[model samples]
Structures are given as structure tokens and as C-alpha cells.
Target: MNLKNKIVTVIGLGNSGVNAANLLSDAGAVVRATDSQDTPATREAQAALEKRNIKVEIGGHTENFIKGSRLIVVSPGVKESSVALQWAKEHHITIISELELGFRFSKGRIIAVTGTNGKSTVTTLIGEILKSGGKDTVVCGNIGNSLCQEIARIKDDTWVVIEVSSFQLERIEKFRPEIALILNITDDHMDRYNNFNDYFSVKSKIFRNQTADDILILNYDAPYLRDLKKKTRSNVIFYSKKEGSSDAYVKDGWVTCVSEGKIRRIARISDIRLKGAHNLENVLASAIAGLRAGVREDSIGRTVKNFIGLEHRFETVDTIDGVEYVDDSKGTTVDSTCRALESCDRPVILIAGGRDKLSDYTVIRGILRERVRQVILIGEAKERIRSSLDGTVESIFADTMPQAVELAGRFAKGGEIVLLSPMCSSFDMFRDYKHRGEVFKEAVKKLKTRRVPI
Candidate 1:
């Protein structure tokens, strides 16, 4: 990773890309960053990096900016089909993700979490558990902070809990974590990958370099991930809601670990604050990682008890006129939205649809029919979603998030749930899932006193 005045090209100029360029420049590399976007944000990023003497290309990438001497580092948002990557491949230049670059310089053992869903929750939980157990910890990566941004804070004793994504895993070369947890792999990011198998293969690369000493925690319910045990040399551990079938599992309302015929209780199911089976799975995975990292059962239990779930993922905004409005804007894939629905306690007036991820909307038809009282669709995927799920339930469309929320208010009645669980990415109508969730909350707030009979 010694750049030492060697030219390094950074493709994409988002937060991670900017951090990568800064990291390379600080490591004494001559860094040049490029992004096709020329927005105000990119210009601001460009201004900040230019002070560090890092060359930045904003409007578009040209051959002059890309024909480099040493290596290429890419941000997760950039496509592998881009001309810059094509050139890198054509010239046989070495390529790696910013995650890989960060790992090359990082000290301490890492706990990396990757899956179609629940990565952020599990990563945060593991970090909390380790810290509570008297271990130095820093949580970074796809849970809003890039590893390069936290390099100065990472120490040799630091337990690095990273929330990794399929995009980040695609270009990793030697980024191996001591504890690698795959929560679950469902069809996701279909827009980026050729198929589900391609996405699955890329995610499996997280443990590709791990030795037998490293541990790979998996979900026993995820059937597709079972074959992964045969693909890796790492020590494998599976977590399940059922008892006795996995290294870590829930038995008789308690979270327990079974190893070498030994059973150790970690936490009671009643102590957990997070709802839903998906979240319970997240807790089980985090507990195993914590115990493996030397966390005591009491410490793990306390952390799990106090750990509230992440925002924009099944967060209850407010109860208006006996209707509960839940925001799950982070459920950006069909599988995630289905999990959210499966966790709901009341009949739902589901608000969904966004930038389509090319997911099969019909896969969710069964859940929609069972749990959802009505479906209010919005954003670019609304029409396609309605088409796929036409006869499953009562369906309608709205052009915006506010409009969708307003419609939900009219259709929802007492003892019913109004859940904003868009099964597609939020690029079509908002900045990100957070913004979409915020808009939905605000819309819900406006309807506190206004209620209509369904």
C-alpha cells in the first residue's frame, strides 16, 4: 500500500471517493479523483481536495486523468462498466476498492458484516457489545462512515466493526476480517449485477482470503448461503431462531451458543428491544461475533437489551388517530420489504414503490395479500409494481411521497398500520432513503388530527 509519490487514480468523487483520495494523498501518493457528476456537492468536494494538492476531475473523466502509473481505487457507487475501469482493465492496471485500500493500512482485527439486509444493525450491535465488554472498538464502513475516514481513530487494539455491501466486496483483494458475518443474501442490486448468482459470488469474496482461524457467521435460514461453507476455509458458525441446530441459536426464549457440546446463554428474547425476525437474526449474528471476540454473556445481553434499531428501517414515527405510521425507507429491495411486512403486527396500508432495483415484485405478493389491507405505490416503480401485484391486493398510485402518505391516511383505519416500506431504491423521489423517510414522517405529522373512515 506504499504509494510514495506514485500516481493513483480514484474513480467516483462521492464521500468514500473523496476519503480515498485524501487517504492516498496523505500516504504520499499523487492522487487524481474523477466523477461524471458536476453538481454543487462535487464542486465543493473538489475545492476541499484541491487544498491537499489532489487533482480532481468533476464534469467527466478523460483519458489524460485515467492513464496512471500505479493503481486505481474505486468508490462503491461507480459501475465496473465505466470507461475508466475499462481502461484500467485494458492497460492491465491493478484495481482495488477503497475498502481494500483502507484495510491495507488498517491495524487491528476486523468484524465485517455483509448481507442483503440487516448489515447496519448487526455491525452496530457487534461494536456496542465489544465496547461494553471493555474492548476498544470503532464502527465504520457502509453504516454511513467509510473506513478511510476513520483511519486516524483506528488503533491496534481496536475491534473494527464494518458494514460491508456487495458493491464494496466486488473489488476487494486482500480485505479479510477476523469475524465475517453474512446475515442473509437475497436478490438485491439487480441493477448493478448480471444476476443473483453474480451478486452472491461477489459477496462471498468477503471471506475469500480468510484463513482457518477466521470465523464466518451465517444465518441458518438462508438456504442459498449454506453452500458457502464448502467455499471458504474459515471456521463456520450458523445462527438460527430455533435451538440446538447452530453454533449460536435461540432456545426457550433465550439466545444461546453451542460449541463442542457446550451451551452458553447470552440473552433472553424478551430483553431485546428490536422487533421482527430479521432483527432477531441480526442480534444472534452479532452475539456470536461478540462472544468470539471475547465479550462476556452479561455484556452481550446488556447491549442487546438497550440496542434500538436504526432509523429509516421500521421506525415508528407517530401514531395518528389510532393509526401507526412506520417508516422503513431503508427496505430498498423486495426481500427487505417482505421481511418488514412479516414483522408487522397489524393489518397494513403499505406505501411502497421507488426507483426499481429490477426485483421481482410478484415474490412479495403473498405477504401483501396476507398482511396488507391496501397498497399505495409511489415513484418510478409504481406502475411496474402494480402490474406485478395487480390482483393480490387493493392497489393505487401516488406521484410523490407526501401524496402517498396522504392517501395512506384516508385508507388506514383504527388498529391498522401505515408502513412506508418502499421495495425499491429512493433515488427517483428523494436524496436517499433517509430523506424519503423524513418526508413521510413530516407528511404523517400533518395528519395528526385528520382521520377518515376507510
Candidate 2:
């Protein structure tokens, strides 16, 4: 792990890769970087790396770079099957992620949160609660800034709350956090893994290296977690929305946490700023992590009461005239979109489609038929979504975001919710969910006329 004076090659120039390269260079590592893109798309990033005096190779991975590197830090976006990766493996070079490098230099308690959904909300909320409690804290990883970027800002008392993903977890070694959390896991990122079991295995790595002294928080209701707990050696803390046999749950409107023989009632579900059953579970997880980090009960209660939800994940974009527009663009999977649809009280003109990850949209049909008033499909997955719900709802297809917004607006009544909760990846139309959400906002802004109430 002594990166000093070592020849390290960062295998991508994405955010994580840039951070890794810069951090390694700062630590006196002989850093060299490589990227696949050389067109106008990646020219700026390539220029930035060269400006930093780091050697840059673009257009393709060079064999010399792989042969010359003593260590390789692969970005999450690059799969292990890349020729450069395979070449490094054959030569016995060490390959690690930015997370592993960050973990090496970190000096405080790490509270790592991993799940298919609700991680960003939970991680941010936990950091906020801890900060309100007077703890020096930094929220980093998949949700926020890279850990290396914030290394100089951290103090000994700093509490690190990291939003971890399966891709980041895949390359980690000795990156154990003091408190590890696995929220509900469902069929997600099916494009990355060979199967559901393979994806689950990588997620379970969040607790793989922990000892008995470390705490592993899990959703007792998640069948995946239930099976993984039996395989882990760490001490477990279980939370659930279901009745009985859980460390935490809500009953008669109060959110309660029972650890050993002690019972603690944190807050009421009605008191929470974020709505939906999924968010209530998020609230519980955040409160527990904050409490374990020695955050004050009053601080936890107050933060939960005032916490505004993250953007693009059940975010209320606008309510023009009468129709309400909600941007849940972060609902990249079928389960999340199902939750978003169910969260609405009014009838929904569900805007759902994007790059299909070979995902089955049939799973959410029951909710679509009962809750969604109409379906506005867009992006590459339109036909699949249309075929899945052909007869269940009035479905329309649009090729672009603006057109989709206009079509959805035509069908949206005064009392209905216009929701952009694409149940697939946004790569077909935009950079990511954030980009998709912003474009959706722009499209909604262009609509000046309001439909008369029926």
C-alpha cells in the first residue's frame, strides 16, 4: 500500500480515476493514466491530466502501460474484461479501486452504506445528523465527492459516511468500515453481473472482511440480506417495516429501535419530511447510524424532521397551474419506479423508459394497472414497456424528452401527477439521471398553457 515512488497507472479518466491519479501523484507515486476515448468527447479530460504533468495515453490501452505499472487503479465504469485489465492480471500486477486507496489514508470511523436504493439519502442524512450532533464528518464515495479529494479536510474526530456501490466493492481489499449497512436488495444492475447471484455476492462483500467487533446493519425483510447474514461473521443489527423480530420498526405512528434489552423511540413517521414507505426505512437506517456514531437524540430527531430529500429521487420539480410534476429520474430500476408510482396519491401519467438493461418491466404491471392512469414511454426501452403493458393502460411512445413531456402533459389532468420515473438507465438520452432530470425540468418549463379541470 506504500504508493510512494511506485509506478501506478489509473485505468480511466472518469471522476474516480482522476481523483485516484491526482491523489497518487500527490503522494509521490509515479502516476500514468490511460483512457479509451480520444475524440472531442474526452479531449478536455485528457488535456487536464496532461496539464498535471501525468503521462496520458488515449484512444486505446497501451500494452506498455500495463507492463510498466506496479499498481493499477481501475475505475468503476471499466469492466474487468478489458484487454488492459487482463494483461495486468496475467503479469501479476496489483489492481485496486479508488475506494481501497482512500481507505488506506482514512483516519476515522467509516460508516459505509450499500444498497440498490436509498443509499444516497441515507448517507447524506446520516452525515447531516452527525454534523448537527457536533461530530466532525465528511460524506463521500458514490454519493458525493471522492474520499481522496477530501483527505486534507478530515480531522481525527471526523466520521466518514460513504455511499458504496457493488462496482466499488468488487475491487476492495482490507477496506472494512466500522459500521456496514446493506439496505433492501432487489434485482438491480443485471447488466453488470452474470446473474442475480453474482450481483448479490459482490454486494455481500460490504461485510465480507469485517470482524465480530464491527457492526453489520441489514434489512431483515430483504431475503438477500437474511441469507447473507448467516454467512457473515460480523455482529448484526436488523431493521424492518414488518411486525415483530426486528431491531427497528414503526407501530402506532412511532419509529422505535430496540437493541438488546433497550428500546428507543426516535421519531414519528408523520414528523418526517420525506414521504413513502421506502423513505421511512431510509429514515430508520440513517437514525441508527447517527445514533451509533454518538450523534445526539435531539439532533437526530431534529435533522429527520427538517431533512429535504435529494434531487431526482422523488423530487417535486414543479406544480404549474394544477398538474404536479415529479422527477424521480433516479428510479433506474423496476422496483424503484414501482415505489415512486405507489408513493403518489393522485392518478399518475407515468413517464417511464430509457436504455433497457435487459430488465423485465412485467414485474411492476400490477402497480401500473392500479396506480398509473396512463403510460408515456420514451428512450430505447419504449417498445418493451409498451409490449409489457399493452392492454393494461393507455400507452404512448415518444422519441425524445421534450416530445415525451408534451405528450404526457396532454393526458395529465388537474388532479393527476406527471411523473418522470424512468424504470431504466438514462444513457439512451442523457448523461445520467441528473442530466435527464434537468432536461425534464426544461421540458416542463416550456409548457405555458394549463389544461382546464375535467
Candidate 3:
């Protein structure tokens, strides 16, 4: 952990990569960074790092750099089996994530949230509640600023709220959160892990090192996580959208968290700002973390009332000629898009298809057929998605986002919804889900209104 001119090599020049390299350099570490892509995102990052005297290798991994470094810091997106990482392992050099490094310097209590979905929403909501309670808080990790950049200057009383992913958790050692929350675990990132169990184990490690004094919060409704609760040694506080099973329960449109026979209730579900049942799960998890952090009941209710949703996750784009358009670009998995469909009360013209995440699309197929009036497919996995849900719903293929939006606009009737909720990834057609959502919104805005048959 000593930063007295240590030679630290950063792998993958992505968002966390560039930020980590900068942080290490700022801490007086001799930093060298590498990435596979030299695209605009990476190139712009490389130029910025160059101004700070950091060395970067783009388009390929350099074995010499890995062998020569005293320590290697990896970005979350890169897999453990990546060539540079394997090289470092063979050379017996220590490899760690930015989160691990951040923990080494962080002074405040860490409230970490990890799951397949809704982690960002829960993390943000918990931060808001703590801040409203007059606590010094920084919402970092996958949602806000990187922890490596934020943790260094935070005061002792500050709260570090992080939305960690399975990728981040895979590399963490001794990075324990005071309140560890597992929102829900579904089949996501199967391509990253050896299997579903491997992914689940990595996520469960968030509470693996925690003591009895630390809090472990889980979604009791999720079968996978509910089963995990029985295995973990940490004291658990369970939450659910249904009644009777969880320590925190939502019944008759209100959410109540019961701990040690003390009940704290949020008056009405309608008062919660974020949309969808998925968001209700987020609110419950956040409330549990807030209570664990000793946030006042009044502050928890007030913050829940004021907390809005995250971008590209069921964001309403526009309504043209009474047809609603929604962008849920953050829904890059089958489970996420399924919740998006469940959130709608009206029939939908769903836009889906992107790079395959090795996810079985059948789970959402029945929901789509029952709730969606039509589907416009785009991106790399269009054919696979159509193949998976053949004859269940009306499907159309479009290579471009504008064309998909145009077709959806044509099929959308008044009072019906048009949604862009690709149940896969955005690597095929856009930079990421944000760019994909922005393009979908722009295309919907350009839709011309015309009289259509109901």
C-alpha cells in the first residue's frame, strides 16, 4: 500500500482505467496503462493521461510492462483471464482492483451494494438518505465517481456508498463494506464467469469477510440470494416486495422494514419517486442500508420521496400523437427488460436485440408476448432473439436505430407504448447503453405524427 514511487501498471484504459491511472500517478506512483481499444473513448483518455506523464499501451497487451511492474491495478471490465493479467500472475506480481486500492486509503464507513440489477439505483438512494440525515456522503463506484478518486480526500465521518459489480467484487480482498447489500442475483454476466455458481460466489463475497457487527442486506424474494442468506455468517436483514417473508415488507402500497421488532414504514408506494417494481426493490434495499447506517426515519422517508430514477433505465422520452416512447437502455439483460415490461400497464411495441450476453431470452419471451403488441429488433442479437421467441410475439428486424424507431412509431397506436429495452448489450451498435438510449430518444423525437388505425 506504500505509494513511495511504486511502479503500478493499470490494465484496460476504460473509464475506471484512466481514472485509476490518474489517481495512482497523483499519488506519486509510476503508472503504466494498457487497453485493447484505441477508439475515441480510449484515445481521448490516452491523450489526457499523456499530459500527466503516464505511459500507455493501446490495441494490445504488453508482456514487458506486466513483468516489470511492482503492482498491477486492473479495471473492472477486463476479465481475470485477460493476457496481461495471466502474465502478471505467472510472474507472481500482485494484481488488484481500484476498489481494493481505494479501501486501503478510505477512512469512512463503506456501504456497498452489489447485484445483477438495481444496484446503482439502490446505491444512489442510500447516499441521498444519508446526506439528508446530514451525513457526509460520496456516491461512488459503478454509478458516480470512481472510489479511487473520491476516497483519498474524504473525512473520517463521511459515508462511501458504492454500486459494485461482480467484476469489481472478483478482484477485491479485504474491501469490506459496513453495510453490504445484495439487491438480487439473476443470470447475468454468464459469459464473464465460468458458470452461474461462479458469478454468484463472487457476488456473495461482498459479505464474505464481514463480521457480526457489519450488516448484510439481501432481497429475500430472489431465490438465489435467499438461499445464500442461509450460508453467510453475517447477520442478515431481508427485504421483499411481497408480504410475510421478509424483515422489510411491502404490503398495500407501503414498504416497512422491521428490525429487532422495531418497524419503520414508508407511508405509500406512490410516494417513492423511482418507477417500476424493480425500483421498489431498490428502495427497500436502500432503506435497509439507511437504517443500518443509523439514518433517522424522517430522513429516510423524506429522501425516498425526493429520489428520482437513474438515466437510460425506463426514462420516458416522448409522447407523439398519444403514443408513448420509453428508453430503458440500461436494461442490458433479460431480467432488467422483463421488469421494464412489467412496469407498463398498456400494450407495448418493444424494441430489443443487442450483443448476446449468453442469457436465455425465453424468460422474458412470455412476458413480451403477453404485454407487447409488437417488437422491433436491432443490433447483433436480433436474429437470436427472434429465434428464441418465434411466434410468441410479432417481430420485425431493423439494422439501424432510426429504422427501428420508425417501424415502432408506425405500429404504435394511441395509448400504446413504444419502448427501447434491449435485453442484451449495446456493444454492437453504440458506445454503450447511454449512447444507444440517446440515439433511440433522438429517433423517437424525429417521428412524424400521422393518423393510424387503432
Weakest 10 consecutive residues, lDDT, candidate 3?
445-454
Top lDDT model: 1
Q: What TM-score, to 2 decimals, does candidate 1 have?
A: 0.98
**C-alpha lDDT of residue 408 in model 3:** 89
- Model 1, which residues run further than 4 Å from truth? 259-261, 449-454
What is candidate 3's CA lDDT for residue 89? 94
lDDT scores for all predictions? Answer: 0.90, 0.86, 0.86
- How many clashes would you count in candidate 3? 0
Poorest 10 consecutive residues by lDDT, candidate 2: 445-454
Q: Write the per-residue lDDT of candidate 2 for residues 1-454, one digit (tens) a residue.
A: 5778889999888888888888898889999988887866457767887888888888999788889789889888888788989989988999988888888888878999999888999999998999899989999999968887777777777899999999999999889999999997778887778888888888889988899999999987776677776888898887888658677787778777765467777888888989998998998888777777787667788899999999999998778667899999999999899888879899999998999987778889899888998888999989988998878888988888888888888888888899999989999989999999999988887774443343
TM-scores of the models, in the order given: 0.98, 0.96, 0.95
Instruction: Tell me how far candidate 2 lies from the true structure as C-alpha RMSD in angstroms.
Output: 2.0
Candidate with best TM-score = 1
Relative to the true structure, candidate 2 reaches a TM of 0.96
lDDT of 3 by residue, 337-426 (tens): 899999999999999999988888888877987899898899888998898899899898998999999898889899999988898889
Native-referenced Cα lDDT, model 1: 0.90
Candidate 3 collision pairs = none
